[model samples]
Target: MSQQENPSSLRLQILTCHLAASSRNMASEKEAALAAVPSDSRTIFDKIINKEIPAKVVFEDDKVLALRDIAPQAPTHILLIPKVRDGLTGISKAEKKHCEILGRLLYTAKLVAKQEGLDDGFRLVINDGPNGCQSVYHLHIHLIGGRQMNWPPG
Candidate 1:
C-alpha cells in the first residue's frame, strides 16, 4: 500500500514534517536573536575591556588586553582583544586603519601564550561570524594550548 494509504506511515510522515518545521523555526529564532543587536554595538567584551565586567586579566597593554577564557576549551585558553574596537566587530570588518591594531592583537597573543608557558605549542583563532561560532561581536583572538590539538577543528 502507498504511504498515504497507510495510517501509521502517514502519521510518521506528518510528525517528521512537523519536527523539521520546528527545527527550522528554532534556527530562524536563533539567527534573529544574534542579529537583534547592531554589529558595531558594544558586546560583553566591551564590558570586560571597560572593567565594567570582571575578568581574570593575564596581560594588558595600552592597546590590547589578554584574559583567561571563562569557558576554556583548553587548559590555557586566553582571549586577546583591542581596547578600542574602532568599528572592528570582526576581522571581516577590518579596514586599512585597523591594520596596526590587528597586528598588535596577534603579537600580544604570542606574548600571552609564552607567558602561559605553552612552550610546546599553542593555537590562535579568530572566529568571524555566526558560522564561525563567534558568540561575541567584538573582534578578538583566542590563544588555546596546554594539550594536544586535533586536526580539522569544528
Candidate 2:
C-alpha cells in the first residue's frame, strides 16, 4: 500500500511538513528583522545601557556594564559592554580610539568572572560579524564559566 494510504503515516507526514514550514517561516522572520536594523543603528544593548530595558546587571562602572546573559550558555554567563558605543559596532569595527574601552571591557570581564566564583577557569568570547554569530551589533564580551569547557568552542 502507498504510504498515504496508511492513516498514521499520513498524519506523521502532515506533521513533519507543518514543522518544516514553521521552521522556514521563523528563519525568514529572523532574517527580515536583522535586515531591518542598520549595522550602525542603536541596538537592544543600547536600550539596556540607557535603562530603557531591564537587565540583571552584575557590574557597572563609568566606562562599562556587565550583565547576566539572558540565554546563558553556562551556569555563569555574563556580558560585558562599554557604556558608550563610540562607533564600536563590533570588534571588527574597532579603531585606535577604541583601545581604552576594549581593555576596560576585558578587565571588567575578569572581575565579573571572579565575582561569579569561577575559580576553576572561564572563557571570554567576542563574536564579530554575521559569520561570527554576532546577533547584536554593539561590541560586548561574553564571560562563560561554572562548568567544564570543551576545546574549539562553538
Candidate 3:
C-alpha cells in the first residue's frame, strides 16, 4: 500500500513498525521497482523500497523485502521483491545464476506466510508479463491469503 495508507494496513503496519522500532539496522525499503518496461531505469517498487514512496513492509532483510500490495488482489496480498535486482526482470529471464536467489525468494515467501499467522494455507503467485497482465515489470512474488484460492485463476 501507499505510504499514506500504511497506517491502515494493520498487520503490515504493525509488523514494520515493530521491526523498525526494534532495530536501527533495519533499512527502509526503497520507492518503486528499480526497473521498468522497455528495460528502462526505475519503477514504482524502487520508491517503495527506498521509502521514497510508502508501503506497509511486512518483512525485510539485506536481500529481500516483503510488503503489502497497494492494489491487493486478495484479502491478504503481499508482494515479495528482491532488495537488489541483479538483472532479474521476471521468471522468464531467470538464468542458471538466478537459481539461488529464486529459491531464496520462494523459501522466504513460505517463511513469511507462516509468520503472517497463516496456519491454514496461502497461495504464491508470480505474474510473468503482459500475457500475465503484469503492469509492473519487475519480478515479485505475490503471497495471497485469508481465503480459499482455486486453480486456473482468472
Candidate 4:
C-alpha cells in the first residue's frame, strides 16, 4: 500500500514553489524595465557558441571565441566571449577565480584588433548591468574599430 502524504510537507512545497516563481517574475519585470535580459536565463549567445546561429568567427580557442557582431556599430565590430560561461552571466558576477578568463578575453580583443588591421586605434567596451545598456545576459567584449569614434558616446 502507498503511504499517505504529509500535509505539512505538501504545504511547504507549495509555498516554496510559489515563492520561487514570484521572485523570478519580479526579476523579469525589473530587467524588462531596464531593457536588459534576465541574468539567470540562457541567452542568444548560447546559440552562437553552439554553432546553432551563424556568426562571422574571427578567432576561436579552447577558452574564448570571437565573432563579428550582427549589428555592426563600426566597420570592425568583433565580440569576444568565453566558450564556457562557468556561471559568469556578466562582469558584475565575476569572482576571483574568473580573473584569468577575463584577462584572456581582453587580450584576445587586442589580438583580433591587430589582425583586423586597426593600426590607428580601436575601442574596447564591456557593458555591465542595465544601467550600462546591456541587452544580452552573457558577458562579452566589444572590439570596435575602422572609424573615428566621438567622445561622450551617443
Q: What is the number of backbone collisions in each predicted candidate, taken in the order shown?
A: 0, 0, 21, 0
Q: What's the TM-score of each model vs. the native?
A: 0.76, 0.77, 0.73, 0.75
Candidates' lDDT values, in order? 0.77, 0.77, 0.70, 0.76
Put down candidate 4 lDDT per residue, 20-132, tens digits, no spaces: 43334344433432444345677677888899988889999999999998777789989999988888888999999999999999889889999999999999988765445
Question: Compared with the true structure, what per-residue lDDT tens digits does model 3 show for residues 1-154?
Answer: 7653443343343344434333342223211211123253676777788889888999998878999987665688899998777677778878898888898899999999988888899999896643343446667899999888877565
* All candidates in order of lDDT, best leading: 2, 1, 4, 3
Candidate 1, after superposition: displacement of residue 24 in Å? 22
Judging by lDDT, tell me the better candidate of 2 and 4: 2
123-151 per-residue lDDT for model 1 (tens digits) = 99997654454557788898999999977
Between candidates 2 and 4, the one scoring higher on TM-score is 2
**lDDT of model 3 at residue 24?**
40
> Which candidate do you rate higher for lDDT, 2 or 3?
2
lDDT by residue (51-75, candidate 2, tens digit) is 9999999999999999998777789
For candidate 2, list the clashing residue pairs, or say none.
none
**In terms of TM-score, which candidate is stronger, 1 or 3?**
1
**lDDT of model 4 at residue 122?**
92
